[model samples]
Target: MTIHQFYQPPLHWQQFEEFAVQLLAEVYDVPTAQQYGRSGQAQHGVDVYGRSRKHGLIAMQCKRLSDRDANNQPYPGGPITREFFFAEAQAIEDFPHAVSIWILVTTARRDTRVQGYAEELNEQWEKNGIDRTATVWSWDDCVSHLNSYPDLRKRYYRDVIQVNSVDDLDQMVLETISMAFNRTAFELPLHIETPDEFLQALQDTQRAVRTGELLDRKSRHVIRKSIGGWRQIHNRDWQAALGKIDKDLRALRAGVEHGLKDGSIRRTSNYLDFADRRKADELEELRSGCVRDLSAVLIEAGLPPI
Candidate 1:
């Protein structure tokens, strides 16, 4: 979808989870009567559940990893740790009458190791009559599958997804970053004086880094240098602001730089680009805030405001 459409108020994680449950139910031809009966509980090692018309029941564990994680080394043990496998298998076993499929739905593109772990878990669960199967679906799979459902597809699948593929995860990340932006943006005037607007902008910069959307060492360094230069321009001590920005920028930069050096970033350019844009947008917001603050100060001093 267009970035604008992807970020409609109804597209938060809660809404996405519901959409995922509903989509899976429809795709498998599970009866509508049985669809609402499906249960979803976030962070309990499960996100969606339902019974298929013929294949029996299905259980899904959704991991909505940020684009940052997509562009990183596969955790050595794969995405499914033994604990996660055991918990999903246990959930299936607990519901004995229905056959279950444990699916790991990620925003990341397909990874062989992650796929392999799912296959291995299925085999292990079979020994206990749990009848579980695991599969990994990425943003690419979602777009391809959704295309068949012309109605919903037409509403949500924009050129952005097609162009970026896995990078579509950025829509979600951007939404998240926007949340922080809004929070800090509103709080700016209330928390500090007009001249201290740089501090507010600095907080937003730190917020972006903490959100993990800035995915490059050099990119982050540029941001930090820019913020530092701005802070000096304003001649405010703002040590607290400086520390927060420095810490977050360093952490985010390290992660992205590591991913870049390992080739993960290249493999997931679509997702990374979106994240990069969010960081850029944040920098722009900071710059704008600086200008606003300077104008406010000029007006307060009875000088012609720029």
Candidate 2:
């Protein structure tokens, strides 16, 4: 196995755009997806477009953002906005092909404002009988996809693909979860911006890690991810670390879903609707504790703390 001290390395903007195309193809089940047009050319707004099994003619505009400043936090005049998406939405109108879903893909953290705006655009466009809908796939969303599809992660992260044992696999899982959760998304507890979306994404995170299995997103069927049944992992240290992370995740998931299901965690399209903010705070605190545990394990393993 190859040795590396780090988990993920920085990717170039062009590389990211290419990676997004491949990822969308996998998620959408499109084998022929490819980049749209060359650089410095007026080829409409889409950076990538392909016909998918589910969404059909999906168009993606990649914005390879930098977390060089703040990984989280955005404002009215920040890097993205409703107006920014509006301009791209208009540009898609000029394209010859009818688009089903026009996704604004970025490498930065998830922004509630952008997500809420996209949700709004989806409603307005759907009502107006527009040709396409809109959505934002932030970096966190991309990471979830990475975790859901291990092949994609291995292909991108050279150091990870070299992992040769179940122990190594657990370490990789820990690394993935560490980076996935160590974000500002879990900052405020029950006051989550898009609770529903968080629930959906968490389903993907649960695909592997401690379980060593994958679940069908729509059905949640527990499919065997590999051979050996329950006897796959043998390393105690790796297992303990992954087990702690999974325990916290299960607790966190239960709390969030309970709040949403029982109407305790408030929400309304873009804002408040859940019934309980206090319970949400408890979940948020659990998330913070999970982050600390992940960092501790990662540091002990000589990897970068999430």
Candidate 3:
């Protein structure tokens, strides 16, 4: 088994605690897990405790080890000593009734010394009729298990790995809106316009208004205000205009529906050409009118300063 070492740099207790919580959340469908530090009264060695679906309620004692010595090995006479193991064993004993399983989650892999300690603890627990297992997982195992969870991987990719700030989010939203408006502008052919062109122009204006870009321009405050005023004109002027468009759309839809219902809708080239020309003319007029309105609004708002 390839034993993955923890990151070479020292990880703070808080960082380890967060990693543990996230891992447990992914692994066993735990509803909640809590972290406790040395400041608490129960801090002989226990670092975390929580309820888990896979193993009932569990207690975890975490031992964070630093980088290995000159031989690049974990065991040296440092913080994670035999004494530390004994203390953790005692802590697990203290929480016997509350938690079903006791675990030692550590940054160190199971070397000879650590394996010996784990075996000793298991033997002691069996002697006491505790019926609990003392499982040990190195930092590498924990990370590997977490990586296996697709949801956790996605969360890490979207939240932690993707380093986008708030400003970047705002800029992206602005750019997307600008691009959509530009696409609408690009699709219009305004020169050979008709009543259909005028309708299309109005539709484009409606789209711009709906997108908020037409209102978002800082220079068009007065025009926006005037439109707002016109909007309130007995609520009837704007309502009547909208009603007329609705009526026209309903008429077109009725024609299509009638044709379909009567089995008269045919693939005729003349009809297709007329429909295409009408749609093009309407869209062109709509685009032209939208641009004119937008320009007038900007001018009325004292944007040009003359």
Best by TM-score: 2
Please, what are the lDDT tens digits per residue for candidate 2 over residues 174-213? 5555544544455444454576667655555554554344
CA shift of 155, model 1, Å: 4.1
Decoy 1 TM-score against native: 0.47
Q: Flag the better candidate by TM-score, 1 or 3.
A: 1
Model 2 quality (TM-score): 0.49
Q: How many angstroms is residue 15 displaced in model 2 relative to the true structure, after the best TM-score fit?
A: 0.2
**lDDT measured at residue 236 in model 2 versus the true structure, 0 to 100:** 65
Error of 1 at 223 (Å): 22
What's the lDDT for all of these models? Answer: 0.46, 0.67, 0.49
List model 1 lDDT by residue over 1-306, tens digit each. Answer: 523222111223555676677567667875441222335432345566677767677766665542333223223333555566566556655443555566666555556666676777777667866555767665556655675665556555443335343223333333333333333433433213232333334455454434323212223321211111222222233323433444544444444445446554333323332235444355445444544444453344344433
Cα lDDT, model 3, residue 127 = 98
Q: Give stretches of model 2 more than 4 Å off.
A: 1-10, 70-78, 161-306
Candidate 3 lDDT, tens digit per residue, 5-31? 222212356666666766666676775
Model 3 steric clash pairs: 196-282, 197-281, 197-282, 200-282, 200-286, 201-285, 201-286, 201-287, 202-286
Residue-level lDDT for 35 in candidate 1: 20
* Per-model TM values vs. the true structure: 0.47, 0.49, 0.43
CA RMSD, predictions in order: 15.6, 17.3, 22.3
Q: Which number leads on lDDT?
A: 2
